[model samples]
Target: MAKRIGITGNIMADQSGPFPGYNRAYVNNDYIQSAAEAGGVPFILPVIQETELLKEQVSQVDGIILSGGQDIDPLLYGEEPLQALRKTFPDRDAYEKELIQTAIAMEKPILAICRGMHMLNVTFGGTLYQDLSHASFAEIKHDQEKDPPLKTHHVSFEKGTRLHSLFGDSARVNSFHHQIIKETASTFKAAAYAKDGVIEAIERTGELFVVGVQWHPEMLTKKHEDMKKLFSLFMDAVGT
Candidate 1:
């Protein structure tokens, strides 16, 4: 049987529609398509406030993909909001926090991307830069204005990491995140780094297949074999 992959969704209020001010739960089609093409049944896990329902949502999926979204609330990591901090949704934060905790407790594999990577770090007691400028060493243009499928920068993989096994020492990837990981979780290791020294990827220290990438592979999977293989790696970890 194919594995069931749950992709976490974002909530947005309808603007100027018949149901104006009404909220909708949605995950980008790229995520669903990437998961399905990677040989897993994809399901969009909507953002909900109910803890029990969130737990049940996680319990049903063979693995979880924490899809990218808004900036994380600075208060989540014990800091006040910075000037460059973008919009944040605390309710979504609450929902995903529960999802991460429940999924880890359940030993489900996780593939966290962009803002999802930020949430994963914060959930594990790590912190973020709030914005790229906050980190002086972040000289590279992480927030690329080019098309989503284009590779904008290069990241060097740490030797012996799963990423290194896939892309060797260095790989070019699409960049689209403003916030960057400030301190990785104690239980996780920085797996890849940009030429300017910003962390590009992270993975749990132990063998649980919990990995996070700063880039959006879902957007590149259609054009890049390496990006597609990243999803395949996650599915392999999920097992049958």
Candidate 2:
């Protein structure tokens, strides 16, 4: 059987109308395509309210991938979002958060991208930069020009970490956000970092394999060998 990969959809509203409608719910194609191209099945899950429904949806999948999108509600981490901060999707956030927590407890493999990484951090008592200049913006450009999602910069890996073992040495990936990882949570270990000293990737400390990348590897999965390696690694972990 093919490895199953359940991805969290993005919560976005279509502002094309005079009044924004209920279009703030969708998943990224790259996220789906990456899994398919890597010999895994891609499953896009919409934001749901009922925890039982969310749990049942994830129960059938072999792995979970959280894609990039809007900022998480600061209230989740115990704070108020600033003027520059983007509001999170309450339904989407609730669904994915519970999905991730449950998935982890179930010992399922998880791969989080961009904002998804931020969500993972916040879920574990970690905090974010909130805004690029909230503290310092000397860091590399968070949003990339080439890929716009996660195909734009190079980052260094911390030696002897899960990310290091997955994609060894130095790696350049796409960047696409203004926020960066600030407070490292006890549940994770810093894996890779940007030249500006920003945390670029993190791995769950125990039970199951969860690696969250600040960049979007899915955007380059077809053309990039290491990117392909990522999904393969995650799928491998899933079957185990």
Candidate 3:
């Protein structure tokens, strides 16, 4: 049977006017395409607050993809918002964080993208830089680089780690993030890092199929086979 993958959707940027006033919102196509490429059935899981409703979302899907979105509020990691940081989305934050936690509790496999990756880190007691203005030794331009053909940066995967197992020792990936993993929580292990020691990828340890990447893997899925490897591995785990 084809596996069911519940992808976390990016919040539609709707601030100028009243929301559609609908309960079941829709996810983007990138998530749906990625999951379909990974040989799994894709389902869009809308953002909802009721804690009990989470189980129903988890019950239908064997895995999830926490798609990228706006930067996480610095308050989440006990840090004040920096001047360079852009606007923050509280409702989106609340929904994704709770959705992720609920998914984790279900023991369903999850693959978190850029902001999604950071979200996983914070959920497990981790911290983020919030923004990259005065941080020393910062070299990577993770947020915006339109000149280059692809949207990625160099990342060094740790040896003997799950990320290394899936994509080998090193690879360049899309880097559409300014905030990054700072002090990671205990539940996750640093699997990959930027050239300047910024955490790029992480995995939940001790018998869980939780993986997160600080890049837009969904963007690279069409051309970068390694990105597909990341998704295939996650789907494969879900099958097990």
TM-score of each candidate structure, all chains considered together? 0.98, 0.91, 0.90
lDDT of 1 by residue, 108-197 (tens): 999999998889999999999999888999999998877999999999999988888988999999999899999888988999999999
Stretches of candidate 3 above 4 Å error? 13-24, 147-152
Sorted by TM-score (best first), the order is 1, 2, 3
Give the worst 10-residue stretch by lDDT in candidate 2: 144-153
Mind giving the per-residue lDDT tens digits that candidate 3 earns over 46-130?
7777777877888889898888777888888888888888777777788878888877777888888888888888877898887
RMSD of each: 1.0, 2.3, 2.7
lDDT of 1: 0.93
Best by lDDT: 1
Q: List the residue pairs that clash in candidate 2.
A: 10-26, 12-24, 13-24, 150-174, 150-216, 151-174, 152-174, 153-173, 154-172
lDDT, candidate 2, 108-212, per-residue tens: 899898888988998889988788888574467877656444456789999888778877888978777888888988899889988888898999887688989
Q: Report the number of backbone clashes for model 3.
A: 3
Q: Which regions in candidate 2 have their CA more than 4 angstroms from the true location?
A: 13-25, 145-151
Lowest-lDDT window of 10 residues in candidate 1?
231-240
How well does candidate 2 score on lDDT at residue 183?
A: 91
